[model samples]
Target: MQYFPVFLNAQNLDCLVVGAGEVAARKVELLAKTPATIRVVAPQACQTIQAMAEQGLLKWIQREFDPGDIQGQQLIFVATDNHQLNCDISTLAKAANIPVNVVDNTELCSFITPSIVDRDPLLVALSSSGTAPVLLRYLRQKLESILPARLSELAKFSDKFRDKVKAHFNNVNQRRHFWEDVIEGDIAETVLAGDNQQAEQLIEQKLQQDEQTEAGCVYLVGAGPGDPDLLTFKALRLMQKADLVVYDRLVSKPILELVRRDAEKIYVGKKASLHSVPQNEINQLLVDAAKQGKRVVRLKGGDPYIFGRGGEEAETLVEQGISFQVVPGITAATGASTYAGIPLTHRDHAQSVVFSTGHLKDGSIDLDWPALARQRQTMVFYMGLTGLNVISQQLIKHGVAADMPVAVVQSATTDKQQVVTGTLMDIQQKASEANIQPPALIIVGTVVSLREKIG
Candidate 1:
């Protein structure tokens, strides 16, 4: 890092700006956001700065720079167009042990302003240390999009409860654990969701829960289907307090973006033939993260319980007696069904719906085809892309009509989503022609015919 990050106590501090042109005016405007008393010294002040000075918002010195301008100031800025004056101020500020910024003149600057994302109580200051302001600004914009607007309010909310949480939970270790839960728990979620009343209620309940449990636990979160909009409010709420997120491969990028930026993100993503991190290792990672008194969110694609192996992860948490809860999500089947205009279950079309995984841990389509076919209800198959041929054949042999309508939805809820409808006999071929792949949903039943009705 080229620059050391520090939050200066600007309140009551004297900060001097030596120019009042647009560039200097911009700096002055940004500094006005803080409580620091600002002094802008320039022979010519901009209309805005002059207006501010007239309104008593700032102290303006309409005179040329004197050596005395550098005296008694904790921080100073030389935003003038004169390079010589900037260099002179830099030398003087350095001699007085004061931090000085010479605007764009990095060579003369003792300090440089960062590309900042201002969330008031939750500020993110990004600096390339005068190396790349454009790149830093680009990154700042991306962070602004991903960060919730209410984060500042949430930070303030946390400050309000800090004393209560500390005093209520006397044991330091226990208090630490309790805070992990509070941050990742409902209070943070409510703020993010813009539900202040519920957030406050959750905070109160969390404090009560802290009193009941000596040590707090963790939560394994299912990030839901690909679209962040499909995420349950509960799931999004749990993410605010995440100290560590163990994410899977199929988890969406936007969903990962919702996690706390400071939270540790560990990729536990697994592929069909390639395991980046094995299932057992993922289980251990979750356990280890929680044991450290950190709020661990095991972010998986779709509903964690539905072919997500979330149950297996929960077992590991249970074995260790880790305090954890499962927040369900819009599974691939539901997400695909809705996004593709196919309902999982309809009173007029189908009485029931079934969700089945096509591929097992051993990479085989081991399922009861006969019973699955005889049910005559809508069957939503997840991870069935690779095994589509066998799935179609099995259902046909097991009394499901070869001509039964079928629909394949790939990359459901995403911009690249594809939807294909055909008979069971040719659905696989049709899906192949459409280049449908995994991380998809397949619905088989007469209900597939209703996509036109719903459309």
Candidate 2:
């Protein structure tokens, strides 16, 4: 959190750049795309800067550095060859309460230029507090490769429908839900495919569906591992139809962004310290939201049934006699193993796969030692962070070999993913060294040895 990010409207503003070298030329070029009055002050102007000045597009001040030159500017850039001059401009600009960038001199500047991803109406600013611009630029390049060129058009398309959605859905909450439907709906898919006609048609159909599905219903959607790309078609379809999305903390942010921007997002995520919404209350909230005829999506991170407590949620929905659907996603065990390059059940190593929770019914590590101690079986433990040591010690105590291979995968299937492998006797130490935290999956057994084979 080195630098606070803020978007500035440069249109019709006074912008000043001091220096006319290559660095200053770049700053001027970036500013030229915006509707701003740009003035450059430098002893020698580059060919591009001079050309702009001759065309009446810019004012060139061919002179030495003057402190008063930046006085009337709203935004200023000091890209001079002289470090002292850049420092002076920065100090003067700060005193005048104007934002200034001293090229590469971060310490002398009040403002630092961020690595920007411009998708016209959609801008993503990445900054490492000016300390790691190269790394930030690398990340920006990666993001640019992944982001579609049609994002601006899609954003404009949604904006066009904003008024119509509000006019049709009188209630604020219902309207918000409708927009979420729009984003997850066929409209987004069609727009992304460059089919405006189909997109509009999908929007119309969504409105009709919204009217028809007036009776509240709930969809228990598993988001699938950490990748939004891994979400099931049914899960995505339901998300597109949601009026309100109540999601857990482990669900990835990029996946959450896929939900409608206007939709009411309620985070009922429970982490170790933060409990915004408790389980029982969350269940009741869903029931109440569904009763109001609003489409509610309970977005979980992994398969609803696999250590997700989805069974409990289903029971609540059934008892309430509420219309509900379950959308299965890739469970943590399966997803982690797949991406970590470890097969949960290798034919040569493991005969069967067993999924177990390290945290027991009493909120303690109470695994069946004999069952887990057996060799030649793949063991996937979910929510094992709190009980890793105990689980490890018990298995060894129950005749399991201390050298049994184990792999701890944190945030599997995500860009921040890390796989740390060791034996039961040393896996915890490996995890500690790697700083492996929850929102993780643990694989224990001889099958973990398959990493060597796969690699």
Candidate 3:
């Protein structure tokens, strides 16, 4: 975020390049792609720069850099090998309040150019803030290969009808939906195939038939364990399209920031034995929002069905005759365990894994301790930090050895992650001493012992 990305208007722009080397020539070429007036000043000129000057592409002043050279320039570029010269120009540009870029020097740059994927009107620009240039180049290549060659044609076709579509939809959300449909549907494909006439006809026919109310739907998305990167592609897309978002306590702040900016957000996060917004009320809230034709996103942490109560929510949606889709996410048992360097299941240590909820609706610690206390199987208990003493006692009472290995992971997969390991007998005391909080996963079995060697 050091350099805010913006597409500056280049029409009638005044641009200056203070070097005439090969690097400077590249910057000049990029500037020439726009309608800007470019001037290059240097004691020597490269072949490419000289050729461009002869073709009247830019004004090449055959002189060394001077303070007066930057006057009246809206943008400046310095790509010389002389560090002192670049720093001097950067200072002058700052004093005059003109945006400047010093090649390969982030500290001297007011702006850093991004690698561009030019699909004409549909342009994609990405940068790494002058760090990891090679990584940025690799990503740019991937984008070029995946993006359609004729995407520009589709963009131009959509641009032609933007005003007409705007006039048809009074609500901003409706306008967004219309454009999404047109761009993702058959009209875009027809335009990409170079059929302007057929594309226009298709758009017109679509508009004519779509004056009725659009039915509201719900997206049941899993935000994944703490890390925002673990979110599925479909989950992110639905989150961006939501008109209203209902999220839970386990959803990370970074994940919440990914929701639609203007979308109304309602929190129904529940803590142990305390429900902020009750389950029935949350279900009704979703039903009411959908009835009002608002696209709702029910964002839950981890896999929606894995003790996330996603099935309960889905049942309510079905009973109410509302349409909804589920987007699965990486559950805490998998994400947190892997990040904590404790594999849930391993070939030699454990052959199977089991996930269970530590806290239940009735505030009971009752569980099939006999089955969970068995050997050669990994046990992951979610939301179990508060009842750690009871969990350990029961397992030991139910034939589990007192020295059985155990690990507690807090806020796994995030910067705030903390891990505590000990035997089942001392794990409760160890967690208390470490002040481990809720929303933590308790792992049991020999897998906890693997951390010393591989973690």
lDDT of 1: 0.83
Query: Which portions of model 3 show Cα errors greater than 4 Å?
Result: 257-263, 343-353, 368-371, 374-377, 453-455
lDDT of candidate 3 over 134-238, digit per residue (tens): 999999999999999999998888889999999998878788888988887899989888899999999999888848678889888889998999999999988
305, model 2: CA deviation in Å? 1.0
- Report the number of clashing residue pairs per model: 2, 2, 0
lDDT of 2 by residue, 292-332 (tens): 88889999999888878789988999999999988899988
* lDDT for each residue of candidate 1 in 199-229, tens digit (9 for 90 to 100): 8887787666625534435676777779898
Model 1's C-alpha root-mean-square deviation from the true structure amounts to 8.7
Model 3 whole-model lDDT (C-alpha atoms)? 0.92
Each model's TM-score, in the order given?
Answer: 0.63, 0.69, 0.92
TM-score of candidate 1 to 2 decimals: 0.63
User: What does the lDDT read for residue 320 in candidate 1?
Assistant: 88
Count backbone clashes in candidate 3. 0
Cα distance off (Å), candidate 1, residue 278: 2.5
